[model samples]
Target: MFIRGGNMRILFVFIASILMALGGLPQQTESAKILATLSMPGRSQYIFVENYLKALAARGHQVTVINPFKNNKATPNMRFIEATKVQEYAQEMLTEMDGSNMWQEFNGYTRLMEKINSCTLDDEAVQQLLKSGETFDVVLAEMIEAPPLYGLAQHFNATLVGFSSYGTDFRIDRIMGNISPVSYNPMIIAPRTDRMSFSERLTNHYEYLLEQVHRELVHLPAMERQYKKYFPRAQKTMDEVLDSFALVLLGQHFSVSYPRPYMPNMIEVGGLHIAHKPQPLPEDIKEFIEGAQHGVIYFSMGSNVKSKDLPQETRDTLLRTFGKLKQRVLWKFEDDQLPGKPANVLIKKWYPQPDILAHSNVKIFITHGGLLSTIESLYFGKPVLGLPVLYDQHNVERARRIGFGLGLDLHQLKQEELEAAIHKLLSEPSYAKASSQISERYRDQPQPSLERAIWWTEYIIRHQGAPHLRAASRDLNYIQLHSLDTLFVLVGVPLLIVGLLLKLSCRLLRGSKPKSCPFADKQKKQ
Candidate 1:
């Protein structure tokens, strides 16, 4: 059925014309080879990142994950390079991270940053990444640990995506540039409520400013050292590389998290780890939960904090309080066994967390207020009691405010305080009601978070770096961004005019009086 030579020429021209007309449409490409790096050693955080990459791989992308966890069952499209030492160090540090005081917390922050930089610098996987000669279409590096990791994008000659599983990153916020005011956006460490008082808002604002100062003075300088060591051949400065990130996959949704203005380059995929259907719990735990005539209480401090590390008095206080409860307690106790066990409480080293939360018998949740836990508890519509010890004070505080829960300081665990909070949440119906409302709002997303993430990731590849998505604020300087200089002119111009008019008036008055000056003196003398 071959066409004649004249006819073939006409057919080619017709097809070429159609392609030219549709040139304005998106240019979709083949699956990308994505290098996704998630090196912060928290397992929950790892799960969130891994889940997204899994979705991408399922969609036919060639995904290589640089991680701290050991290899799990692998897939044809997925590969893992684990940093074992970095993994072990992070676990050890987080176990003791709930510091006793301000100095310890500040010191802990610095030491952890130092360890991350040093450990990652010596990480064998990182060395391999630099020398492997393997290329990627995109480099998605975790931004929570260190800024130097962003330089990996320059090394790969790929689009940089700053991934912060911590939900919010002030650094990335500044990088992508949005119209975020300091007044409402509290720092991760500030324990402000959803409804801030005038003084509280001021405190949050000042604390945010102080944190920015610390990042500039203490944090960035240390990260810059690693950046220099990593990508020495780059023509641009490290600051330039940091500023040029093509996308930021933030683990925050404006609906669940505080509403803030975001740029196109910043994509929020808040609940990527939440499975559509929760996996089933173990046989014994399932039976126990089913047998509970009274409701159940589930407690976990997440993977980082171990129950044994708690002070003896604190452990005693918790045990004594739980012993009297009528409801069944499912505790994620790390120990093989609790020495003084309570009849009402069941001890398991671990349980299928989401599954337990989904159970009808469960009435309340007690957690360390890891962001993942906070979000999941709400998703399941259970009132929470937050004992926030490490990392984000704001997460637990926010949970306490919105999730109909009470927050307690990890360092100051009193027996009465623990008992009262537990009793109140269990007996009161308002907490559960509040939790259900938030859950309804959260589940009302137009699409699941994972779909949005995958779409944006592929969007970056389709457009070959989507530079148009960048916020206009990224190009602005401090004076221009805040319009401080413009404000000065607005206030100063009127004052300047008044000053000039006043001077002219005084000069004219003096000139009018000058003619009588000599005669006035003579008359006075006579």
Candidate 2:
């Protein structure tokens, strides 16, 4: 009986290894087809492109990437369309986030869009591809940054797939018919908690309305101009072109983000970035982490926010706060030298972030609350202390309220406040416990997220855009969607009855009014 059980276990392991090698999707039978992609909003977004595009290529799809980053090296089945020397927009955006002037932030943001448009329009690679006779089975683009790139799909007569770096924004929500209720659900970019007070709800509603108005009044017009500038020959309107997207691959799922009512055309492929096994940490880092008597704390502001760029006071406060802690600290500081360094803390310019979080001795993460880092901390069951800089980061507050972590304001940062927040996280057992439980649920899927992503991608190709998955709301206008047309009729019909009754009663009170009426007059004549 023992031998049989051992054999069974070995067989199970063998089959799992085979699946892992094939990237965990079903065995491919279809011949390779062309799948072009454009997702160069930032370095981190490009990281996602490197992940799934390679997997798609491995599954026998020919992949062509139009990105600013050079990470996706060409192969027999893969190619690159280099957008000439585009700066990483995330760094500039972070700078704007730290600024006081709202207009400055807005201008910085507008500048980013212009750069993206200019890069594609002027790039020798993109220009050649746009004018070439090449075709692709599909064209995937980043929904947030590059809506104009949808023209690539239309130009090639290929299916359109939108790749969302994080959760759905208001525009994507309206398209997919998955807009969450602001009464209970927070806005996509707003950092409000789920359970809101009356004032909070009112604020959320106002923000949602403002976002819609801005897109209609400001953003969409600019996008339409770009769309026309790029693909002048295409006949479809901008809204029509957007709705034509066959599927949207979003960074959301049950454990990492709040529940959303998604339509069939929307696919949640959260944690696809971290689906693979992490490489081992450097020997020095391994030794430092393993040698700590107490657990270690990992600090990173993600890829874009250099620790050196932080104000001197902010850096000094963090150093002092970490110095006071017994636990060892490892910071993803981009500089080789941080003067007045603490003995308890270590610094590195870059890190295998996921691998470090996987270590048992790592206690918590102090992060910028960037979506990828936020998901990884939760994915690995490590408690977090979020110092959010910008964009969808306010959702970090939800993590604190749910007992997985705590948050602090970066602009208001001080040594004592930083010290206290760390202390609270370390002392609280509930945070760690909650994180662990959630991690278990997050990994408890039937198939890996990468496999799921690959399957859906292939599914769309096989079915020629998967048209049945589109939601009815895609065809609905605001009045029809809200049933305002029905409401007006309901209200108007009742008012009409009441109005006629009032007129008839007034005629009766005036005496002999029925005889003067047209029907009464006709009956009298007969």
Candidate 3:
């Protein structure tokens, strides 16, 4: 139906008004092209990052994931590039790991970081991707140890987002410009808690200073060399690349992790990896779990640390202890054969951990206290017995502090101690109560972690890196950030003023005639 000229003008104005009103409301964002790199070796690490990437894809974003462990089946809106050399290196390093020696663990991990950076950079597929002229709206990479990977954001001319599988550490705090006060914020490797004694605080400060020096002098220099070699035409240096990160999705929830300060750009997506609906347990494992008249105690040493690597004596102690427990034991043992395996205990090379924990009959988790495993336990509302062998002590220690679990040194574990702790976790109602309370608090978020992560990622994309969220401290140096220069001015100025006043008074007193000195005159009269 054709309208009259006057009526057409009226209709156009009415349509324009409706369009203006619609524009005032929130609009749907454009689907983003996201390049996510998870270079870390552990399958556990892969799980967290993979879940996040899948969530982005589910939101209709195009995501390309580069990692050592690639999924066999590709989902819609997602592509996977396998870094095979990295996979081999990780397997070799993790297989030969000796978790009892802290120095060895540190050194091995340091070497692994070097390998991850070099291998990922040198991978044929990654090299192909580099030269393909592909563009990404955002480049998300695990920020734990691979500083060189930060260059990818610059390479793709994309917004930088850091994904921390290890949660917040001195390195993460440094990169994100979060103020980590040594007095209260203990380093991840530090054995001390947030509440520290004078000596502990000193130790914490020393640890921070030492790691800072090592990162600057040793680790980052090597990464810088790699960055220069790989992306020679890149504008920013490695250090600048580190500072350019728009957001960090941290694997920590304040409900479980240490209560510390975080910048606006630093987000906590603690249990993002946990499936909303966990998979069903295999039939045999299901029967074993269900048949336990008493509850089941699930044991695992996480992905990196193999249970079969335990010392024979330690394995024997574990076996003997499990034999005493009335509850059924499901252990993630790499080896198929346990010579003296208990009738009540079932051993497998792997188990669907989150699924196992989700079962109502699973009461206590005996874990290596890795962050992901602990977070899973918390998600499932189960108490844990942490056998922490290395850096994982921090995770277990926090659990102990929060009364969700107890930790024991894996190298120094005793059968009696193991048995007793297991009994304590099973018998004590408070531990279960704490686990339940913390789990409720953890689950009580404005939205689920995955949704929050996707929203933030897209937020950065919509705002073109969201530079406003970045901390201003990123632009400051050591003295400026700590305000040492200002502090010196504040303290030294007052001190110098007092010193000058004292000097001036002394000069006046010395130069004045004896008669003009009232105090001197009084003293003489007396």
User: Which candidate ranks first by TM-score, i.e. highest?
Assistant: 3
**TM-score of every candidate:** 0.87, 0.87, 0.88
**Number of the top lDDT candidate:** 3
Model 1 lDDT-worst window of ten: 512-521
User: How many steric clashes does model 2 contain?
Assistant: 1
Off by more than 4 A, model 1:
1-29, 91-107, 512-526
Cα error, candidate 3, residue 399 (Å): 2.0
What digit string (tens of lDDT, one per residue) describes model 1 on residues 1-526? 9899999999999999999889967555688989877666667767777778888888899988877778869787999878767766766676445578644565567668667766765787779778888888898888774666667777788888877776765666787786666667666777875468899888877777776776787767877877787767865678888787888888776656777777877888887778868788788999899998998999898877777778888888889988888888998988888888798889878788888999989999999988788778888888889898656577777876775788888789998889999988988889999888888888898888888888888888998899888778889999999999998899889899987775566557656563445544466779
* Candidate 3, poorest ten consecutive residues by summed lDDT: 95-104
Candidate 1, after superposition: displacement of residue 448 in Å?
A: 0.7
**C-alpha displacement of 222 in model 3, angstroms?**
1.8
Model 1 alpha-carbon miss at residue 126, Å: 2.0
Is candidate 1 or 3 superior in lDDT? 3
Root-mean-square deviation of every model = 6.1, 7.1, 4.9
Per residue, candidate 3 scores C-alpha lDDT tens digits across 393-469 of 87788888889999888888888888889888999999999999999988888888888888888888889888888
